[model samples]
Target: MKKYLVVLVSMLGSLSMMGQTNTWVNDPAHSRLGFVVKHLTISEISGRFADFSVKVTTSKPDYLDAQIEVTAKIASMDTGVEMRDNHLRSADFFDAEKYPTLTFKSTSVEKTGKDKGKLHGNLTFHGITKPVVVDVVYFGTVTNPMNNATTAGFQIKGVVKRSDFDLGPKFPEAVISNDVQIIADVEFSPNK
Candidate 1:
């Protein structure tokens, strides 16, 4: 009788904990997913995917155990130059018409400091998926004055090789650098 009661209590406790997990959705108006890569080994060019969504679920306030998922529309990519952007969407680059989207789903997050961590995830782009580790900085949470809602801010930075995913194969390192730097500034609010 005592063993049965204990088991029931344990199960209930687990359920309660699960219920505490919060789902946060990105505030698109305050977020940017951008990247930079060298152009001609001299100058650098920057671009951004204007359409993306990020959702994070966690029970901890610091988000140490957060599970994050991201999806960005490849067709929304903008490089400030119409011709270059069109080129990037073609088969020589992302082939946006065929792939349509890039995604990431986090596998683990390791705390490194008071407000920093390493996020490990699988990034799918250009029809290829690869493991990636990005540095994360939590800028803490604040109550929005206009909406009276709590918002959290974070910055994620990483570098990925275009060659690894067979992106822009015709472009050499001297013309277009292989290393692409990704930087995202995002804000999230608890889903209502």
Candidate 2:
């Protein structure tokens, strides 16, 4: 009976570990990684990375202790103008050839309300990493009719200084604003 009790305890431990977290894949079709920056200290230039991936791990329905990671391809930036987009990918800016991807990993999630929270994370870009805090809004969840998978939506907004990442020096602050505004609309579906 002692041996059987030990076996049962091991099984229960395994089950608890397996159920500790749920994995969710970002749905690219319904997600966007976008940013806006001021140009010539006047008009604003907006762009987005066409390719990005995100994974959300959570143990609770409220997402109070959730963790998130994201990767974005620098070569996929689109600013509508071909020349400007190419310039952004060159050594003058992001240098997509050397640093192919920008990444973010969350450290903490603080829930403020039923659908609002503050997400603190480390954002890595242009070979530098810095802590950033962003406002997050949860849009609840739904079951997809096509695949019968549970999906959740979220919107995140934050601002980061380009100079903090050592990304740009070719243009002065007057020519190009140092601040970059980030906005992301993300949809995640549970992994099968």
Candidate 3:
């Protein structure tokens, strides 16, 4: 009876270990969410969303089993020009009042190298949900010299069609390009 109890306890402990997950929260001060879009076929205009949050969760050390979620406030968009920023929040563009947030939830993560991978997810913007695959670079983790807290860094690049997300003006690829390039530099720390 003692032996059976020991085996049962060990099995339960193993099961609990297998189910454990680690969570990391974004450090906004060290992260950025930015995008580039063409302007009048002249040059590219770049901007960033100043308010956003990201969370990563995984049970695996390699992060191959990671799940990521991000939420960004639409009103936080900044393009340097106040007029352009206001236009982006208007009805012809992001319609920020109706859809105040853009979000992404990872559906899968595919490892390609020791520090590279592809993150597949659904991005919801302007009331539309579209699948997107982002090229990822994991910069690994480090202990901050100032605070001694462990932090991880990552960079992601992706593109999404503005039309697909029902954002911005229509039929003007020559003007504002349909394709928007998204680039993010993210830093994460263990959730407290």
Candidate 4:
């Protein structure tokens, strides 16, 4: 009967909607993308990108099946020192004028534990793309009292070699360590 067919179609549509993926956008006010590297083989220097955007897509509430993408402006690097920051953005290092942005797109996600996972992705920097893996810790989700919006938190940590991307090739290892530690703490809310 026509009535029965319409009801069945509506039921199926609702079920499909329940399984649809949701997109989450990073909250800039609650997120940070930073890095640390050894300076002069004794001290460490830390810096963060001032402009970036992250997007996450998932069909699960736990983020077990999440796909993440990020774009960060290379010229936005801030190390609290204007001279050093400008030098870093020059051709001697990032060459920010040529490669204006760094980007990452997840290839796969492997769950290591209930709240831990390994995120494998392609990181593109300085016009080079390399596969990288980062450890992810899900801090779970909470409802914000101010806006009544559900927000999810995650911390991602990884180590990258500057040599791999041919970054700062002019600087010796003793002057600037080849190893750079990347750390990002991000909060995401469903895209409106």
Winner by TM-score: 4
Global Cα lDDT for candidate 1? 0.96
Candidate lDDT values, in order: 0.96, 0.92, 0.93, 0.95
Residue range 1-192, candidate 3, lDDT tens digits: 999999999999988877789899999999999999998888999999999999999887678899999999999999999999999999989999999999999999999998999999999989999999999999999998887888999999999999898776654899899999999999998897
Q: Which scores better on lDDT, 3 or 4?
A: 4
**lDDT score, candidate 3:** 0.93
Candidate 1 wrongly placed segments (more than 4 Å): 1-19
lDDT string, candidate 4, 83-177, tens digits: 99999999999999999999999999999999999999999999899999999999989998989999999999999999999999989999999
Q: Report model 1's TM-score to 2 decimal places.
A: 0.90
Ranking of all candidate structures by their lDDT, best first: 1, 4, 3, 2
Mind giving the per-residue lDDT tens digits that candidate 1 earns over 37-148?
A: 9999899999999999999999976787899999999999999999999999999999998999999999999999999999999999999999999999999899999899
RMSD (CA, Å), each prediction: 5.6, 5.2, 4.5, 3.7
Alpha-carbon deviation at 40 in model 2, angstroms: 1.8
Top model number, lDDT: 1
lDDT of 4: 0.95
lDDT, residue 79, model 3: 95
For every model in order, what is the number of clashing pairs? 0, 0, 0, 0
Candidate 2: residue 174 lDDT (0-100): 93
Window of ten residues with lowest summed lDDT in model 3: 165-174
Clashing pairs in 2: none
Of the two candidates 2 and 4, the one with more favorable lDDT, higher being better, is 4
TM-score of every model versus the real structure: 0.90, 0.88, 0.89, 0.91
